[model samples]
Target: MSSTVVETRRVFEVKNLDVYYGDTRALRDVTMDILEGQITALIGPSGCGKSTLLRCFNRTNDLIPGAEVKGELNYRGQKLYGKEVNPIVVRRRIGMVFQQPNPFPKSIFDNVAYGLRVNGIRDRLNERVETALKDVGLWDEVKDNLKKLGTSLSGGQKQRLCIARAIALQPDVILMDEPCSALDPISTKRIEDLMNNLKEKYTIVIVTHNMQQASRVADYTAFFNAEALDNGGRVGYLVEVDTTEKMFHDATDERTRDYISGRFG
Candidate 1:
């Protein structure tokens, strides 16, 4: 009998990617592919470069002084870190949501409209804002309160608003850094559900310490760990990247198994 096969396209191809802050190497020899239209989770112990790696996706690392990257990084078969690449353009296509729900102090409608305005999207502003808000499941609650200050909302609502802000730009990839870290269980569940839905529309890369959350939302998972050096310093590197089911249940690397089993991080 003949078998049918399916192919998945890669959105980001990272080869021997290393990130350095001044003289210190924060990440080392990282190599992986971020597949298109799937949620890829970056899970690991603290200071293991999960967040650092996430920032590299959209070149947000450029914002940090002394931050430098080496090795090849490609997005959509194009060089992501090439001299001709514009960090602003990269960010416009690859949006980010920080660990904290950092909504502008502006009104709710203006908050979601912020990116649209900055990008010079003048036509159908209301439609775009409405679509993004509805996509993140935030419109119903804040529809009438569009003029209200975003900071006045509850923590969960604010985070959802931040998410709306990102999606309003219609980005191709969404990089979330511990998006639900500060929220309660109820809020976290809401965000997790939202993530599962969003993956159908945008490629997602999340840096999470919560193994359960990774298993719940991610289709693929990459585990990172800190390797000690002779000089009393450490560098974070990818241990394994695999289907979430395999990574959580049958990871090949002992370190991955250990981290998943709560043995060590």
Candidate 2:
């Protein structure tokens, strides 16, 4: 008898997931399993629900007015959308970094310390901040400017600070929505390296339009595409999910192949 072994353990299990904004369906029946301690990139053109799917992992979509989500989304076998689940608690466990760097106007130290404070972690606050900064490779650059306003830093520095803020909580997973989209090529390379290092400690899910970035950084890649509806609109859905190597070179889905080849976004 032959048997198959699943080596990668799943952190998030999504089944038949659908998201809606008012009456318009944004995502439809998107289902995939995200592995723990690995980088999974969501790649697609704009308006294809890449960000929507990213938000579903931590329930950030709940904060959006008129947004509704259906189907099963489980975090480590726990019902993610259960009535007993607290969005605040969920966010702490699954932190997020946005498209643009959005550090608070507070001091660099305080910005990284913000989540720890909100979680009432007063002990060793400085140590935790320092560790988080070090994890993102920002400690050497900003160690002398700990008291400086976070906003005073350069764009790349601000992004690293935001990453440090998220890492301070020691989150199980980190959701990044185009984190390097607004940075220069050098800064983008730095963040890519940071992502590779972070996967040793945390699972990462990123929404990116850059195919090269996905191919370069992700271990697994999921392709999303929009389908036109009869009502003259569209709904985004998952087209394929596979190892980065296979997805780029041997994708089974034609849609995925076309998208990866730059035939169509």
Overall lDDT per candidate, in order of appearance: 0.92, 0.94
TM-score of each: 0.97, 0.97
Backbone clashes in model 1: 0
C-alpha root-mean-square deviation, each candidate:
2.4, 1.9
RMSD of candidate 1 to the truth, in angstroms, is 2.4
Residue-level lDDT of model 1, residues 94-122, one tens digit each, is 99998999999999999999999999998
CA lDDT of 206 in candidate 2?
A: 94
Which one wins on lDDT? 2
- Model 2 segments more than 4 A misplaced: 1-5
Give me the overall lDDT of model 1.
0.92
Q: Count the backbone clashes (under 3 Å) in each candidate.
A: 0, 0
TM-score of 1: 0.97
